[model samples]
Target: MYKINDFSRLSETQAAYSAGNTNLLLYDLPQHYSDEYRSYDSPRLCTIINGAKEISVNQSEHFVYKKDKFVLLPPNSTVHMYLPEHTKALVYEFGDQLIDNVRQRVSDKLNIDISKNDSHETFMQDTLTQRIDALNRRIQEIVLENDVNMSFLIDLTCQEMVYELLKIKGSYDIIYHHQ
Candidate 1:
């Protein structure tokens, strides 16, 4: 396992993998970056490995994302972001198909329909558990290896992440909020 504190090296490795167009996750290592307001077409889980990110939604609610915490942004939720220098982060954008697949499996296993019924859209944040950290480390390791089957492995990991996120309490509401 790669040392989690080795942010620079990890960023470099991630960049190298991404350059080959084999990266499924977005590894951000920005000196200073900001966006006024933007939205995604899919759900995105932003995990900060180092430094901090300041985010604001609707220009009203503000959040600061740091290590050991992650934010899940549902589709069509506009938000602004500001990242300081030397910030290392990984963003996993989950496709709707993958999310629905996992949601169905979980719902079937639990025998409960997991769907969003809220009238408004919302995002969520939670502490990064050990299981999630381990999976993330595995992803990093796999990317660093640059194996021929990197895409398959990365896809599996990303799917697992969606499954894991769904397991979190009340995640379904936020994930399906846009509905």
Candidate 2:
């Protein structure tokens, strides 16, 4: 059971760069940097920018590298990650608000009721990695430029990332399904 403070501690120690709002965390871990068991308090998207890493979740091990660059961790999922030398990744921690808003918009657009199902499950989709990578690059550029609307751009990019995930086949089912 990980709390917010645990995330804070881990971020402080592992994060190479972290956003002031705490929504984005960038980690550049050395080879064989073993991240012991840890869980998140909220849903998060982990994207590998370079190198390779292994993540164990629910007794399953996943190797996320260049070809397969992203994994989504559901809230409260205990995970162990092993990063190879010079592994770099971006962690996007987000609440349900953005998802909910997107769901609402999607539902409204399709004229369907999405609230009938609500399940909290993590999803791993490699296909969406490229888009996320592009978004990350754009965000990084915007941040580097010190854009006055950095906050807004970040928020929009975050939403776009979630939207892209939701667009994947079966992703919406995983997220909106109820037990």
Candidate 3:
């Protein structure tokens, strides 16, 4: 797994990648970076590689996130973000079709009806496990490779990540939110 400094170096050597509507970008922000309110029209998964974020959603109290942490925000959600120090992160915006397809497939394979459940929530936050970290690294590798098949590989890897998340408890609420 790559650490914060490793990711910093990797991001410096590679540019962001986009496929269809999905985007995977690396952010290297200076200390004290603040955004009063940032809105997402589509679902996003932000993974912190270094530093920390103080985020507030729905006018709620701020939540602090540090290294190896990730937050999943549903579409149409907005939040305020502040970086206390130099921060490096991987921000992945998921295309609607990709998420839908993956959800449907997982539901079918598991024989579970995966439908949207209304829930009053801001976002889902969790620490990265070894498996999840490996998956993220794979996506980064594919993006940096920038090969002719990069788009396909990214879609596949992200689908795998989504599938894994669905298997976790409580993720359905956020993943299928606003479906």
Candidate 4:
């Protein structure tokens, strides 16, 4: 539950959210900016959930279709997402077993149906942002009150959030296939 703008680098550009294991980043990509470097240059899964999504990985250019089309990278894989102006993206990055398990569980609830189409919506990004914002606000309230259960709340919020996020991202695929 971290805001990208709060970071020092976010004032000018997007950067790592924190030293923590997991974070969500929202940003827009410069159109026609990179035609040579075709990789994310980082070990992370990049999903283009809104606007035009173009990616070059393993030396091949591919367009990611919408409605839950996500790219899965297994660490150290350079990746990039091409987004048009006003593009919005919701990212989920973490490495803890518990965190992974929570995501997996939520994904299981959706039946793990990956999308083949690439059409996406900005509203979805805004919705996920709202959820994360709610979690951040909850943390602020607890910290302000000097609550002793801060850690528990934080952990609980992260787990529940991962589940919610996974569901929101893929529930369309899930609901589509399960029928």
- Candidate 1 lDDT over residue span 1-179, tens digit each: 22222224344344433312123444454656776533346666777767888888655577777878988777766777777766777666566667677677677675444555664466777889888888877887877897888778877787677777777877776665454
Candidate 2 residue lDDT tens string, 1-179: 01121234554446323333237666666777776544356566776667877777655756555525667766666677776556766677765676778777776555443444344545554645578778878866766787777777777888777777776655565444421
lDDT of 3 by residue, 1-179 (tens): 12222223244235546666567767777888886543346667888767898988667788999867788877766778888888878877777787788877778676554455656365788887777789888887886677788888888888888777777666666666655
Worst 10 residues of 4 by lDDT: 119-128
Write down the lDDT that model 3 would get. Answer: 0.71
Candidate No. with top TM-score: 3
Candidate 2 vs candidate 4: the lDDT winner is: 2
Model 1: lDDT of residue 167: 76
After superposing candidate 4 on the true structure, give the runs of residues whose Cα lies further than 4 Å from its correct spot: 1-14, 35-45, 84-86, 100-179
Q: How far in Å is the alpha carbon of 86 misplaced in model 2?
A: 1.0
1 versus 4: better TM-score goes to: 1
Question: What's the residue-level lDDT of 13 in candidate 3?
Answer: 33
* Poorest 10 consecutive residues by lDDT, candidate 3: 1-10
Give the clash count for model 3. Answer: 0
On residues 15-68, what C-alpha lDDT tens digit does candidate 4 reach at each position?
544324444454454544333221122223334435555655544455554424
Task: Please give the lDDT score for candidate 1.
Answer: 0.65
